[model samples]
Target: MKTATKINTRLVVFAKAPQAGKAKTRLIPALGAAGAATLARHMLGRTLDIALSAAVGPVELCMSPTPDDAAWLGIAIDSAVQLSDQGQGDLGQRMACAVQRVTQLEPVLLIGTDCPGLTPALLQQAAEQLGAHDVVMLPASDGGYVLLGLKSPCPEIFSAMPWSTAAVAEISLQRMKALGLRVWVGPMQHDIDEPADLDHLPPELMNL
Candidate 1:
């Protein structure tokens, strides 16, 4: 029997507590604040399940707003990193912190809860690809990334980029290319950030 070679990669899932008035705030207009909050909780729960089931190595939950809030969610992970909205500055800062923390132990793959499209197979591919590349980014159709894995902690890629726009992935790709960094691009995934994004999700996800 051939034994599977374990990849020394840290799988980090970034999340936030599904608190009313705080979680899924963008969907409030269409799904009321209370409804949006409920959906956010459901979505996050599902995301955590997927991560826990597929993880091949140490997993980290990088919770925003507060990590303590995620304690009651009952999601099992190797570690949890609390993030303060402070000094986050923007999405870049938060992402950088996640990578830095995990890269201290091993290669890190950081993903968010928005991508219901993420699967265990894809994550494994990313980890394997990292063996030959400096970075691996799974671009989203909306111009962001669903997953980003790195062999080394590179803050430049995450900082000073225009976030929450279609150019995010494009700009990051350009930066990586310019720096002569060997990058691997994975299959694109859809992120559930806006109302239109809801259409791309499974029926059960939208109902939740």
Candidate 2:
């Protein structure tokens, strides 16, 4: 009997330290500094849980403000999971760097901690699609992307683009087309960012 070969697909979670005033600042007006940070912490935990449950492959937590920050002490991550700094630069530079580093080991699916709708099945679906597509994007309802997976490093897709605007997904697809990279897009999902987005939060996190 022959054993089936496993694909080397990594789930890279891009997260910020859930510190008051530093995390989820956009929602602070509605939830206060502490409350917003609490929500950030909850979202990060949920994201991590979903990634682990997906069991697609190894998981990495790419932290902003570094992994040594005290804000990480509140969450319990499996010691087996890899931890690394998000490195210097804007969102584009940071993601490009992270993707470059991880793609050396295996293809990577990069995601943020903001989307509560991200599930294990969705992560698995993205990973599975990467086996055929050059890139896979899970578009967000807010015009950004909730997830991005790449079979290989393509820095052009991440460079010189506006980060927080509605044009993000549109511009990204344009760049991918310019590079002649094939893209697979998943269903749209929502992220918890502004006060209006609070209604989408899970019931347990709605107390805020």
- Judged by lDDT, which candidate is best? 2
Per-residue C-alpha lDDT of model 1 across residues 1-208, encoded as one tens digit per residue: 3333347787777777777788778878888888877777777766666666666566666666565565345544334332333226578988887777677778888888888788878888888888778888999999989899887778889888888889999999998999899888989999887777777777787666
Candidate 2 shows a clash count of 0
The stretch of ten residues in a row with the least summed lDDT in candidate 1 is 78-87
In model 2, where is the ten-residue run with the lowest total lDDT?
Answer: 1-10
Residue 7 displacement (Å), model 2: 3.2
Per-candidate local distance difference test: 0.76, 0.89
TM-score versus the correct structure, for each prediction: 0.86, 0.94
**What TM-score quantifies how close candidate 2 is to the native fold?**
0.94
lDDT of 2 by residue, 1-208 (tens): 3222235689999999888999999999999999999999888888888899999998899998889887687677877678999999999999999889888879999999999899998998888888778899999998999999997788898899889999999999999998888788999999999999988888877884
- State each model's C-alpha RMSD to the native: 4.1, 3.4
Candidate 1 ranges with C-alpha deviation above 4 Å: 1-6, 69-87
Error of 2 at 206 (Å): 1.4
